[model samples]
Target: MKHKQAGLSLIGLLIVAVLLAFVFLIGMRTVPVVTEYFAVKKIIHAIAASNPSMDETTADIRRDFDKRASAEYVDSVTGQDLAVYKHGGQFEIGIEYSRKIPIVANVSLLLEFQTDAKSNGGR
Candidate 1:
């Protein structure tokens, strides 16, 4: 007669638990940045959908971005930081920014995010 084993041993379970904990720790540090990007992207989409005139100047765009950024809680970039230009009667708004996520003492992760929005009329 042979007895069969169907469960993970102590060492195997320990390894699995450690791996899960590591993943969770990293996710906790990184999830917020991803969510913030979505918020900024939403604001961009909103502005694009509103059909802002191409004649608006950089200051005008920055002012509008400030209002929307405050409402959306987007602190990463402002209109002044964005690269705004017009191409074929379509406004292009773009930003390149980076986020620092701290995991442990002197250990951190740097993430770069870039997003853009274009006027609907141009499309």
Candidate 2:
């Protein structure tokens, strides 16, 4: 009777351990995806603020900013082109980042995450 009880308890412990391991693996896989999404969003916001006027020809300013921001980015999965333009009094900026998930040695999950932000240049 004691032996039967000990066997059941050990099996229960093993099941719980396996479940925890599975959850840990999933969390690890998802962390990079969430991180890249937010990083890209931050870059978009910075670009929008830096380019106040579409006609201002702010490439030098934007290039410097992109250099700093892109350093935080790993690599692009889709659009590498960053664009800035103006619509009347508002400034528009576009940023895109590519994200890749490794599923196999030769296959990957590729996605392009893009964001646009507009501002009217104010306090």
Q: Identify the candidate with maximal TM-score.
A: 1
Cand. 2 TM to true fold: 0.60
lDDT tens digits, residue span 11-122, model 1 = 9999999999989999988888888888888887777777678677767877888899998888778878878787777787878899998888999999998888887654
Model 1 collision count: 0
Candidate 1 stretches with Cα past 4 Å from truth are 121-123
**Candidate 2 CA-lDDT value:** 0.64
| lDDT of each candidate versus the true structure | 0.83, 0.64
TM-score of each: 0.84, 0.60
Q: CA shift at 24, candidate 1, in angstroms? A: 1.2
